[model samples]
Target: MPHARTAPALSLPIQDARERLRVLIRDLAVVRGRVVLSSGAEADHYVDLRRITLHHEAAPLVGRVMLDLLQREGLVPGIEAVGGLTLGADPVATSILHASAADPALASLNAFVVRKANKAHGLQRRIEGPEVAGRRVVAVEDTSTTGGSVLTACEALSQAGADIAAVAVIVHRADASRAAVEAAGHRYLAAYDISELEI
Candidate 1:
């Protein structure tokens, strides 16, 4: 009889995963030029986090780092699920759940996505995926400038009966985001802050 293959390790060293993400963000995501942000503010530098979060190699790294932040920090006890706003946050939420499959120590987390607006037809839902009602959820975003996007999702998820436990972002470009999220009563965490990306 053939021997069963062992499952690979689900979690990496938190610092190593964070370092990998830091390098990936600096190399592949930073774009130097004037660009309009999601908040409609013009900025000289734009960090295109999707470039990293959506990449084949970096996406997994992003998920690992973020899960480490949430799981290891004891920030949101009993967080049963994770989610974020559509488009920017889709990958982060998905990746973390995917990565969790390998780690027996972590609870399997469900992923939900909040739409920019409610769909006009079908279920006509503002939020999609597993029912988040009463679920402790950690919301993530790709890049946060003014915290508007995460706030939008949080409000919707909250209304849907989800306990918005905490918020995480792959790239935090300004203190405004941290302040805004914290003010809303959710501890804000980041894989890489703006100052860390200044290279």
Candidate 2:
């Protein structure tokens, strides 16, 4: 029998992924008019992440890029599970799960979704995962401004006794997030930064 071909490792330039993501944002996602940011700053354009996450083509591409980033940052070797705050982390986490599932070498990493709060009844558990305790985890997000959301998710994971390996996002808006993640002693990775978007 012919030797089975090894699956090729996926890779992409950080800049190229940013440009492609912008194209997807412009073509598929709607851009709201200029609006003030929570930081009291004026902005010319708005990026609705849902546009990319919900798009048929863009969503999968996002998954690939995110998985690629994890590999690029060297966190893939340490991560046992991937997840973050719900709604935003939902798609990315699912994508990571899919990529891992398709590759036997990567299949060891499981995916989970973190709830903003615990369930009202039954388990009343704050986390739902396949025994993430003591496991290394990387929290995924669509965007990060002040890192509050990511921090909250990290707190939850810490409470559950999971070591937060890193925080990876589709976009990193400011330096504050980088500082916070690093200050917390976790690796931080992003597919794009605000300046890279050329906005």
Candidate 3:
């Protein structure tokens, strides 16, 4: 008979995972050049976090680091799901969901997606994957400059009867984002900032 194969452990110490993710972001994601942002602001450089968020190695680290951030901040307990706007937040939310699966304590965590707009036909829903109604969920993003994307998701979530636990991100590039999220009455958390990436 063939022997059964065992998978390797998926969890890591929070600090180690966080440090590794920081290095990966600096090396793989940060692009140095003048460019206009979605927020309509020009900057000397841009941090394109999707590169790391979807990377094989960095994706696991993203899950661990983001989960740890929410855990330490005391937002994970009552939270039933995690997600934000589609595209950017999809992988981030999925990463966290996968990471949570490795830990029984976080096993209840699930993921959802907020569409840019409600589908015109069929279900006509804006939020997808596991109903968020009446549940507490954390909004996630790869990165944010003005907090607009996460906030948009939060609005949809609110309309769906979900309680916004907080907003979390992989990288926080601007102070304005923090202010914007807080102004909208949601706690803001980030695993890393641009300065921590040594950029």
Candidate 4:
């Protein structure tokens, strides 16, 4: 009889990762005052996750934590690609790709970006990088408010023929993004909700 195969278990301590992320977010990403989101929604507080995702100290932490979350939560089974809207999802996706490349147990995953719209020239592609056709993917974002950015990215990915496995983000600012994502029939993961932050 053939034995059943299983995924390699995740062993990292998520609480430690959370503490590190919490400090990094508090010190570098959290800002007070009103700002308009990419969704055109106004907010009294802003979590500029790029502040951490782009950092030397925090970027790796974000990647490790996110990958850990995916693995621990059993969200990694079918995902072959990771990415979302250009700027926000860029670093997070890169981090996961790099980390996966170094880890033996994790599947080698490709990263991709979704343009807000198709380019006018060249390939005129809406989703750029490796081909996503027929692959399972997870849409990543630096922060979320209305979830509009992640949803748009996923829509493009789906149109490009990728099956969305889940949505991941550095911070969840409100309920809308989560609701919107789940309502679309995909699982969602957030490293930290706004309530977890000091600001």
Q: Which stretches of candidate 1 lie over 4 Å from their true place?
A: 1-12, 75-77
Instruction: Please write out the lDDT profile of model 2 over residues 77-113, one tens digit for every residue.
Output: 6788898988878788877777676556764678887
- Pick out the ten consecutive residues of candidate 4 with the lowest summed lDDT: 3-12
lDDT of 1 by residue, 1-199 (tens): 9755422224557676778678878989999999898788899988988898788777888778888788777843378888888999999999888877656767778888899999999999999999999888888898788899999999999899988878898877889889999988888888777889865
lDDT of each: 0.83, 0.76, 0.90, 0.84
Candidate 4: regions farther than 4 A off: 1-14
Model 2 whole-model lDDT (C-alpha atoms): 0.76
**Cα lDDT for residue 115, candidate 3:** 100
Could you tally the backbone clashes for each prediction?
0, 0, 0, 0
Please, what are the lDDT tens digits per residue for candidate 4 over residues 9-34? 23346577668778879988888899
State the lDDT of candidate 3 residue by residue for 128-177, as single tens digits: 99999999999999999999999999999999999999999998889999
What TM-score would each prediction reach against the true structure?
0.90, 0.82, 0.93, 0.88
* lDDT score, candidate 2, position 7: 27
Error of 4 at 107 (Å): 1.4
> Of 2 and 3, which scores higher on TM-score?
3
Note each model's CA RMSD in angstroms. Answer: 5.2, 6.5, 4.4, 8.7
